[model samples]
Target: MVADAPMTPVDIEPLPRLARLAWDRAPALCASRDGCADYHRSWSMLRLVRAGGKPPAGWRFFHAEIARAAARGARRVLISGGADAGLLAIVASGFRNAGVVPRITFVDRCATPVMQNRLLGAELGLDLRAETADLREFRADGMDLVIAHSFLVFFETAERARVVANWAESLAPGGALLMSSALADEGPGALWRPASADDIPARKARLQAQARGAGLTPAEAAELADVAGRVWATRPSDRTGGLTEAELRGHFRAAGLAVERIACKPRADAPALGAARQRRRAEIVARAPG
Candidate 1:
């Protein structure tokens, strides 16, 4: 039998009650009226109640890297994307566990998640710097650690290089960028294949069931399901797709960061939204050369 990896000291705290409240209020707070609010609302609900509320795969590796940076007297952490405060909380907890308190900056285009992170920060008694800006255009310097989980998939193939370059520029020498991406067999320029019309009912039903299980009222669950269907039906044709392993690595190296470590593994328990295709999850640690 393969031996399990030794456990690291980083512990992922449970999603705070305020974070849940932020998610619960997301629909109203979301500025995107074109089904974007519904998109976030449904996904946030499912994520909150997903089996065991488990952190994403390879979280231990992320924790270890964050702890190491903290031990090295690193500060000025940045989170490149935000759908919720979950990533912020994880990074903060990692630094605290490592016996260092780092200043954290969170950037996201959407105001709702920025507010959410602010609320979460207050709840955790941590001062969080939250910004509303697109990652491709946002810039900072002297960052010791930057993290973005499942963030790259949202950008088109042509836009990814710029985003990676921005990430590299934001880091100080010897600073690290820790990120994860969903991988696919398809190459660049491949857009996510939208769900077929026939599949919408089944997908909505599943989401509704999951929402109810997550404590949404029956009516609220139905609304969430309806909104999800609308969003999927109208999903943009240019919605960027997953990156192939090669594309992911190339983007990092092209941005002038040294690829320190990368691990990709199949996610057996991924939700059914894209279950028809084989998708792997990648956890990467890249560093800016001193």
Candidate 2:
């Protein structure tokens, strides 16, 4: 049996009352029209991060493997966060281009993704199902590939361990999990609330300036700002965090997964996001025993 992993250092301050309430009510809250709008806006913002017409950096990191699997007729995939329906759609599009049709299952607790997937999946002609269910209560078996981006960060360590264990068990022998998120050597959970009024605007302005500096036209910058605003609507109540490489490796081992490949990219704005002295964004691929 794999030993328990060492816990990474985390700031254990209580979440704000409002944040706590929002977390508790997220499922219901996100079932509304407004929730759909929030997700639509977030995906638009995500496009800027990926520089349009390209897969997000994280997805690009593992696309080759996914395509190879599809080529081999291993076309069953589960994208764990329906909020990531956009990613699922993109993957499906890639498969279509290669003349391979894949079966996809997109799961999330929020209704927004479920609604979005129906529309998007139909438009893309992908065989898929979007499920809205609490991760703890969700179950599946024999998936060939699982993609979960920005999903694990929502849970605390013990809960994350449970969730990963479940996903690992759900994997078909030799199935793999591809995930990406930010990680820190030392810090509170990766979720960041604004530190102060001054800090918030300063960070926003810096991001805008960076966009402009990247040669984005004024109109493009304005469009990105609008998308960013919608995404920022939940920043005050965000509940996301990450683990160090060592911590992540330990977690994988404990969950009965073998680390297959891993990569990290230093974020230029890590400090602005309230990360500790050393934080890096990470992508990992792990596999179950065949």
Candidate 3:
């Protein structure tokens, strides 16, 4: 979830007509629907409402992020899950401006991205393509960038690892994998969970794993247990290990990508709880073999 939006996804009435029209023309979504509190949060949810969230008054921040990526020579970046074409277009535009003209390979379970990419590609004459292939089998070794913001967090523990491992394979050895998530293992410790939350099981699993990795037995794992906030915590996560700092490092160790850094601010209202207050996860950059 985004910092601005409420922790939970409570449905709010959509914005007015003029508001939506004005929003559609801009870049990113200010909220999930339009005017509640789900401010620009995950690269995923934000992508769903990109055309329906941003007011004409803003879009620079959205443009800037894409521009920076294009400037770095991301000529042909891949948006793993095609559902975020709006988000991909945001970056594609930047790549176009840089004269690189990106080709977004929208990979998803359905043809939504295929349809969207076809339209956008036709309009911009971009080399966009949509694929229904499984991530493990999809090819992507020469791409400049690969992204899967929140989609991977939906996988089970073992599946998540396999997905990341496959992502590692798809990458051209040194290409980058920029994933966004709500989980993190960097914190003083967690205190209480919101009445509507269910991260304890995942927390226990990871803490247990950590203790085991730290030379603890099952009994010891139970003894040295605590919440380290959420890792790649976008809900429906079994454990944040394959995505959190610890997980990122662990995956990188096996994948060859050295994580650069993570970004987020812990919860402010109840920060005194000493919980890890952060939103954005980390961006892991790897070097592809030439």
Candidate 4:
């Protein structure tokens, strides 16, 4: 059941006003909600490659662990940054099929995925709700589990820590948070960086080469270039990037959550440039102390 009182004080700070504004304008700026599906499919393909053409070990563990939580009586599950609804759908379906009823909530601002999630919930007959809410201001106590995958990278470093604290505080004591992401060993760079004067030609050349190598027709390549350019146009300057496993654990611990488990491997599918961005990625499960 949802708790009557909030576990923590309301988060007074908001992400940079620009960050919120950009996100609010994303639908219009990008003019492509279907890209969300493509994004979900790309991640699935990445997992296959990382597993040597099989499902990644981490994903297997992810499913098994959620089922275990459900079996242990976890009923209120929240998936933060569930904008795509792809992972949320899988989680809800798994619990429903396993006969473990859960009250699943999707916290995302985008309307497209929110609509997608509702349709999915109706089809699966799972108890699910999509809330177009800002996670920074989100509050609920007695949450059994929270999932945040590929989420923290959207904010600046300090913002990431604060958000983590909010999530940890929202959980009932001993409740768990599941997170997975590729991490950089050094500075947490922008998730999407703008091209500088020197960067313009270099980025253009790279995109052209990539498109040609992928066998995209001329029109498709031009379209991809247009999309790529627009992405940079909307990028937040202080966007968060990656963190080492130890570094991520430190964030949880600092927030009063204990590091429960960590699984890591080099990015098996990363290209040369991608490898420079991050050497490896990790899947982590951390819990609030009971």
Candidate 5:
């Protein structure tokens, strides 16, 4: 039994436009040799949208923090390395939920997500700037809040430090950096692999169910499941080994950011997704010195 309740149409209404954009564009992108096509194909807009544009855990805390930042006069926000509009929507909802509006800058290396975000921004009447840029080389100063979701794992171990340093430099004095990372034991290799062979089938089934629940036809859901399974089995995931809590804190400290909070917990949906190992999810909040 899928533990989550059935979603009402209103719950998913905001997603179809973006989903249409992704679905229409993914095939051409795949044919054009875009490296992220596998990801886009596997986690279709249906899947992403059905996931409710929120992290599996600690989302309340994140939402609260965003509201608090806005209350404290945070107006300039940066969303780093999101591959789609999901995180942008989540952040925008956070501000609106608190009756605040902040100017947002969203950066990703992929043009597709940039375009999607631009569409979302227009729909929301938000002051959003969408750009395609590598986060490692991207530079902007005086941002009041910098946010990313499950982002660090996408970078190799060596690149993680540089990314954090860049985020630090992008912040205004006393600005905050809020992010989440999956934590695991450090290993020599950086490649991300399925936790176990069972992980593939379990994840595929979940995706198929989510796709169906999001209103895809049975055949469409099955196709998505097939693509997701094949991609998971054959493709090298664009992710590196997870970071340890100590390593995460060290990086923030080395970047001269004071660690305000590091809340670690097992992901609520991890077991359902067939994560065999006990991977801890960490929500990090850090601040630059005044």
Candidate 6:
């Protein structure tokens, strides 16, 4: 993973309990807001990392990919922990109204937004269910398609490994799991926690190590480092902050997923709400058999 050379490495210490609880209070705040969710849902992720590069083109790109899978006899698609549901909506619409339909399901931790999505789906007459539980519970077993859209980076280091392990275990052989995440210029499992220069590099490295213990070789580790670079560049104005490249790469390797394609860009609409500047990605990782 690409990282800044530490001028001097010092022993790191844990945060105070009160301070730690408040560690990501801001991200939680952002997640709770409507405007923020809307902006991010509109491909704001493309704005970061790809200022001059191509925009995400939205989940239409993913829909086309899924269509290809259906043509090849794939069935059942699962999207885990996708809070915004924009991508889920597109996928569900395509499957329900379009010829290349797959059974669509969605899982999220909270149901407030998900319930709203379910109502919207009802109005559209699409059969999409949003469950209030960890994504790990969703099973696309023996199903033709599985998708983890912008889902992997939601947790901390150990959580990424567990997330991958669960997803991997759930996969059916020859049933491809479509996994996507907006990597920072750093690593894959990065969430935009407000970080100080003094704190980020070390914590990032530790997480990277945790990822390594989970899987990725050193070389592969560095390769995954490019996820958030586009985001950092695309939205220089973002107060939420950018990712360190090392952090992005380290997480992918840890998850046992390789970088299949890394297309850097911003959305044409210049949106920045749900989780803007999403680093475009498509990765196919080896799933261990049961």
RMSD (Cα, Å) for all candidates, in order, is 5.4, 11.5, 15.3, 10.7, 6.0, 18.1
**lDDT at position 2, candidate 1:** 17
- Candidate 5 residues 1-290, lDDT tens each? 21144222224225666666776676665435447765665453634535654333445666778878978888899999765676776677677666677899999877777778888888779999998888988978899999987788777767889999999999999999998766764445442333665488888788888888877889878887886677666533234555677788888989999999887776554554333544577788999998
Winner of 2 and 5 under TM-score:
5
Give the number of the best model, judged by lDDT.
5
lDDT of 6 by residue, 165-194 (tens): 566555565555565555454334443433
lDDT of 4 by residue, 48-155 (tens): 222222322345555667778887888888888754445664576456545677888887755545655566667667788787766777866788988877677677
Instruction: For model 5, give the 10-residue run with minimal summed lDDT.
Output: 1-10
Q: Which pairs, if any, clash in model 5?
A: none
Against the reference, the lDDT scores of all candidates come to 0.72, 0.62, 0.48, 0.60, 0.73, 0.46
**Which pairs clash in the backbone of model 1?**
none
> Which regions of candidate 4 deviate over 4 angstroms?
1-58, 186-225, 232-238, 269-277
Worst 10 residues of 3 by lDDT: 6-15
What TM-score would every model get versus the actual structure? 0.81, 0.69, 0.57, 0.65, 0.81, 0.50
- The CA lDDT at 205 in model 3 is 69
* Runs with alpha carbons beyond 4 Å of true place in candidate 1: 1-20, 33-35, 186-198, 231-238, 269-277
Compare candidates 1 and 2 on TM-score and give the better one. 1
Ordered from best to worst TM-score, the candidate numbers read 1, 5, 2, 4, 3, 6
lDDT of 3 by residue, 1-290 (tens): 11232211112212232223222322342233322122112222222222233322112333444456667766667777644245455555455445556666767543434444455556556677776566655667677677665666656656666767777777664566665555544555443345334656765566567556644467645633431223223434444332456665666667666665455444434335334433343333444444
Q: Candidate 3, after superposition: displacement of residue 206 in Å?
A: 35
Candidate 2's clash total is 2
Q: Order of candidates by lDDT, top first?
A: 5, 1, 2, 4, 3, 6
Output the lDDT of residue 42, model 3.
25
35-75 per-residue lDDT for model 2 (tens digits): 45445434534443434333445655555666666666677
Clashes of each: 0, 2, 18, 0, 0, 41
True-structure lDDT of candidate 1: 0.72
